[model samples]
Target chain A: MSDAALRSPLHAEHVALGATLVPFAGWEMPVRYTGDIAEHTAVRTAAGLFDLSHMGEISVRGDGAAAFLDHALVGRMSAVGLWGAKYTMMCTPEGGVIDDLIVYRRDWDHFIIVANAANKDTVIAELGARLAGFDAALEDVSAEIALIAVQGPRAEEIVARMCVRGDDDIHAMRYYTAANILLTGDIHAFAARTGYTGEDGFELFVAADQAAAVWELALAEGAGDGLVPCGLSARDSLRLEAGMPLYGQELTRDTTPFDAGLGRIVAFGTAANPRGAFVGRDALLRAKAAGPARVLVGLVGDGRRAARTGYAVTDDAGTQVGTVTSGAPSPTLGRPIAMAYVPPALSAPGTVVGIDVRGRREDMTVVALPFYSRAS
Target chain B: MATVPEELAYSAEHEWVSGDTDAGVVVTVGITEHAAEALGDIVYVEAPRVGDTVVAGEVCGELESTKAVSELYSPVSGVVTAVNEALERAPEAINADAYGDGWIFKVELSESATDLLDAEAYAASVA
Candidate 1:
């Protein structure tokens, strides 16, 4: 395919900034602007802006929207109020995860779901097929909506300055909530207080044609705070340090939500359960009761040698136990960290293991999730 | 991208080979600017220890960036005489100054391994 086929709205801006562009999820996204460590440190200490338009957004509207989503997703749909967002998953009947997504209640009868870019088509098809019997309308709005994520310590202040209506009081917005703001005459944009960097941030959804203008505004307003344009390389490092799971890496069609250590998102017997008959409920309940055979755990390596994806996890005696799902030399921690799945017996914190990186063995220690958490 | 140093000979695999025949045919090896650009950012580097024997086209080290890990192949056969100790503390120097203080290892060539590319040839190969 031609390179023009996958260019995003900010392609020219990225090139002008001397970004290293790479193919990611069918889109030509910047892997790093200037350098990875610089961008990573910028997000940790100051602020960073990201062009996230490649993410898929699908909307479900109608009277049965809530019921349909409750039956289709793993999280409790009824508990979320209008303008509330919940991180949830769509799983297969055998309890394997199809995709982990965020569901936003746009209104009483409208819901918007955002999914990974690579899995957009599959997610839409599956949702449509499942909701065919229900009274709801499903539409794919990925091509029409553009997203920009402003993240870091000063993200809210920067956004407040760019927005015409709201003051810095928007900074008071709690996490996982979204509000609509009128940036100009009759031009409304939705801003969600959510992020993957484990920092205070907002994701703004705007019309496709207005994306570049909004990005320019955010950059101008945030320049004084040391806001730089971040790319996929820094994005990976930041999220890895925050212990957030990437869809294909940490969750996949063959991996169950329970096995991925996301049982808290599943509401089976709660009062807010709109799940009359959701997919994977039975198998998930059984797995929850009996406990998953394997669980995902965080690992910290002894040195700078990173244990990459697909590296084998083994005991000191060389018995193969699990495989690494995602690993990197964390820019923030200045050491190698990873996430992997091991047998239940070896999933506890402080379990000593070795990662077979190529032909060499690197010592590692199993640790709790969220290697770094934002101070409350 | 950083400038390719004119004094150094380069290999098709993007490694720089610099040395003098007067100094017992000793050559210092490091990755090129183009290689560092493609790798994005340097995170970890595992160099062969001093006195370890290496053959041409053999893996002598490993370089890990934020995106992926790649094996560093030796351009000539030799025994490792010196290894970069600074990489253990600050590997990003490879991304910053690939040709100078970021040199990875030094080797005393067994017989002056031939067929190594020059800077122009190496640049053409990458282009």
Candidate 2:
């Protein structure tokens, strides 16, 4: 580990759990505890804990918060209900993705924007610069908060068990919503029904100083629900199977939401829902008119060899057509799956393409975005 | 601390070979526990074929894991005499026991293997 790498508030807890620590986005975080496949399977069948403190949480407060967000991001933030959450994105003036974000409406004039760890500073700077004309304040509360996620099929029961109050709220909570809850140590937390894993889960925002206590409480209460602490590997596989685009991988400064097939998140103003001008509104409007040059699509390999990131997507005649962004051997699907950027002509499901996995060619078929989805 | 068998020889590439380096004798080969743990769960193993000639300090196969894929190098030059075919269906056997049932392949030494490190020296280097 590098000397300059930062540590999470739950660092000692992770070490006590014998987690494999890795430096990611400047933070020394747990990549896994027991094993990747095991923790992945646990989330699918039972429960898994995740320390997401490395993610950036910035607070936006003041009367103009919602309007400012609606102007700064490609979403109708003003339309989000109280205690509601919306998955949105910030972009450059050129319609390129800056970072995908999840904004929580904590109150009428208070909101929280969670951003990717690596892009935290950049997002803060951009948000700060955009606040020139708005009556809002931006404060990075990432250091004050520690995020703990309990995700999976049994997550509800496990998280409910840790709460001293709000069990009924936990049981009655809706997805993409947040609730204020009190835990075993009388610690107040902002718990949200949101997660990167496709499974049903909750993300608890607690005080950084009490992070270990909350972690232990959840572990103790969830012992019966098989809540094993997971790492980045399982989290990556889970999010990939859910077809969620990762910031650095699937979404980049060069790619627009339209290219990633996530234009729905960009709510452009129209005659009826006349939203104010937001960042990238003009360029994204142009992008919508011209259509994406390369469309993001999912692929399933026909062979055992996986098509990894940067692998060339080739045509039948051995011509390079696209590039793979993220890939893995899906533990749930028992096959190699990947997300790649290909032309609109080859983006349809069942379109056959070849991947240059190392020196050999592995045939992959275009599939729908998600290779795996939980049963509702 | 990772387990390092005293009777084995190791390569900088993390492959462990049976102690004997005399020419014309077959030597068993597998990755050390240190390597397996560092690689996370081994999902797939691509061992050199039984007839393929593997050169020391050269990449001959691959070990694909959950997080990343690593090249498997031959510690000693030889023809692959045998391979652990059981790994095809149960690659996690490497993570379960990298030195025992996880032994990847056996090779008939084509020449005396040179520059092989003893268990103690290899352990110190990794440490």
Candidate 3:
């Protein structure tokens, strides 16, 4: 395909900044600006701006939006208060994950689901097929909306400086909540405090045309605070350090949320907040009752030879037990770290495992998720 | 654009050969500037050590970056005479100055090497 076919709204800006453009999730996105380790460290120490316009945005409107989502998704969407966001998943009837999504309640009967870039079409198709008999309409607004994230330690301060209205509301905006806020130069945006980097950050949802404007504005406003325009490479390492799962890697079509230790997002009806039948509820319940066959855990390697995706995770007996989903030299930890699914028996925090790092046995210790966590 | 020095012999694999190419002459070897820029921030590198024999156009070591790990290929077949020990703690030197402090190893050629590309030809091949 041509480069124009997948260019984001901020494509020009990235090019001007000398970003390394690469094909990712069908979009020609910047893999890095300046350098990987440098940008990753900037995000950890200060702030980093990311153009996430490639992510898919699907909207559900009409009175049955809440009910439709409850039936279509694994989590109880009806329980999400207005303007509140819930991290959830949509699964096939067989309990396999279709895509992990964030459902943001816009009104009493409207919601916006942000799906991963590559999974957007699949998610939209699934949501549409499951929308029968509900008073709702589904639309893919990924082209109309642009998603940009400012994430890091100084993210809040930088984002707070751009508010034209509701500055206090921006500051007081609770995590996982969304609101229509006015920004510098009279730009209107639906902003959220949600981020994948495990930092204090804000994700701005704006019109596609205004994306570059907001991006440039943020870069200029955040220049003093040491915010740099980061690319996908830094974003990947940051998310890995945060112990979040990337859809294609950790959460695939064959992997269940329960297997990834994200069963909490899979809601079963409780007496206090009773939920109706949802897709994959029965299959997920079966998965829950049977327990996870494999568990996802963090692995911290001793040497610089980092484990990579598709590398075999081995037992002490040299048996191939599992596969690494994501691995890298973490900029925060200053060591090699990885996330892999291993047998439940060996998933303890201190259990020793072996990763075949390019035919070499590199020993790693199993640790809890999120190898690095920031102060709240 | 990354610089491809005209004085050095180039290999299609992007390694540069320096010094005398005569048989039994210890020639210096390092990755070209273009290769270093493409690899991003190199965190670790494993170059063939002294006494290890490496073959031309064959895998000899590894150059690991945060993004990916690439296999390093020897530009000339020979016995490794010396390896850059400074890279053990400072792999970023390769990215910072690919043709200088980044020279990975020195190989005493088993025989005079043949079929190496000139700077112009090597640049065109990559382009």
Candidate 4:
């Protein structure tokens, strides 16, 4: 890590835990505490706490908040229920993705949008330019806030114990719903049943100064349940196993949601009930109608060698078909898995393909989207 | 704080060579504990062919970890005598016991190389 790199609020805690720090998106963040595989297994079996403070948080408020967001994002913001969170994306007019974000509706006219750390400035600038005459106010609250997550099978029991509020119960909180929680010593925080890992979890949004306190408190409360402090490396592998698309990897400015096999995220207008009034509506509709030329697919390799990002995906004839976006040896599955973008004709399950790993065309079979999912 | 065996000859690329430097020299090669720790979990080890010849400081194979792939470089010029076939099914043995059971291969030296560093020198170089 460089001297001038941005540090997380829990930087001290990570250093105390002997974490290996690395530079990610201009921020010096913990990549692992003990090791990547160990932390990943902890999340899958027990629980793991993650410091996601580097993510961006932007607030939108005013009477036109919902309307403004409807025009700003691809998902229908007007349909977001109170205290409901929705996964959506901001796109260019040409249907190219700008960033995928999650919006939490605090009230009818107030909402908070959490975005990726690397694209924080891009999202702020693009939204600022598009809010010329909008009645909503956009405030970047990234620096003032910190995001922490407790994820696993024991997540609910652990996070439910952290909320000191007698009136609010975390057990009653539905998935993707947010609530205000009062912790010990009157530390107020916003808790949501949301996480990147494909497990039951809760994300706590707290003040920057109170982040370390909350982190220690959560870890202590969940210690007996096997909650370990994880880092970005484990988080990446866990999300990849869940079949989630990363911002710069699976998504980019040149690709539309349809190209990533996420066309359902886009709200195209219908004659009977028109709701497509946002950017990229036309281009996305055209892409949807014509069907995406290429689609994202999951690939399972025959051996232990993982096909990492930027590896070339070739057909049986050895012709270049697409490129790998993300991949790793799944700690749970005991096999190498990856996600790549290939033509729709070759995206179906059982399609034979080859991944060019280290100049060798390793055999890979196209599988389903998610390689692992916790039983509900 | 990785374990660095004092009796081993170390290469700048983090491989440790162990054997008697006799008239007809043969040495067993494996990645150091420090290198294994830095590489995260070892998932695969690509070994050189038994009859293949490798030169010092040349890439002969690769070690695939959970995080990324690292090149395996030869510490001295030699012809491969044997490869660790056990690693094909259980690569995690490198993470658990990188020095003993995780030995990657053995090479019969054509001309003994004298540029390899001792344990202390290798530790200092890494530090």
Best by DockQ: 3
| Model 1 stretches astray by more than 4 angstroms | A1-5, A184-187, A271-274, B19-23
State the displacement of the C-alpha of residue A127, model 4, in Å, after optimal TM-score superposition.
Answer: 0.7
Q: Please state how well chain A of candidate 3 matches the true chain A, as a TM-score.
A: 0.98
Q: For candidate 4, lDDT tens digit of each residue in A1-376?
A: 4888899899999999999888999899998898888899999999999999999999999999888889989999889899899999999999999999999998899999999999999999999988877899999999999999999999988887877782256888999988888976578889989999998899999999999999999899999999999989899999999999999999999899999888888877578868847888889889889998888999999877899999999987888889999998888888899999998888889998999998888888999989889999
User: How high is each candidate's TM-score?
Assistant: 0.96, 0.99, 0.98, 0.96
User: Which candidate comes out best when scored by lDDT?
Assistant: 2
Model 2 C-alpha lDDT per residue in residues A57-98, reported as the tens digit of each score: 999999999999999999989999999999999999999999
B1-127: candidate 2 lDDT, tens digit per residue: 5799999999999999985899999999999999998888889899999999999999989998878889999999989999999999999999999899999999999999988999999999899
TM-score of chain A of each: 0.97, 0.99, 0.98, 0.98
Score candidate 4 by DockQ: 0.72
- Give me the runs in candidate 3 sitting further than 4 Å from their true place: A1-4
Instruction: Flag clash pairs in model 1.
Output: none
Cα displacement (Å) at residue A191, model 2: 0.5
Q: Which pairs in model 4 have colliding backbones?
A: none
Cα TM-score of candidate 2: 0.99
Interface RMSD of 2: 0.9
Residue A193: error of model 2 in Å? 0.4
> What TM-score, to 2 decimals, does candidate 1 have?
0.96
- Please, what are the lDDT tens digits per residue for candidate 3 over residues B1-127? 7898888999898999997688889999999988987888999998987999999989999998888888899999899989999999999999999999999999999988896899999999887
* Tens digits of lDDT, candidate 4, B1-127: 7888899999999999997643359999999998998898888889899999998899999998778889999987889999999999888888889899999999999887788889899999877
Q: For all the candidates, what are their Cα RMSDs to the real structure?
A: 1.9, 0.8, 1.2, 1.8
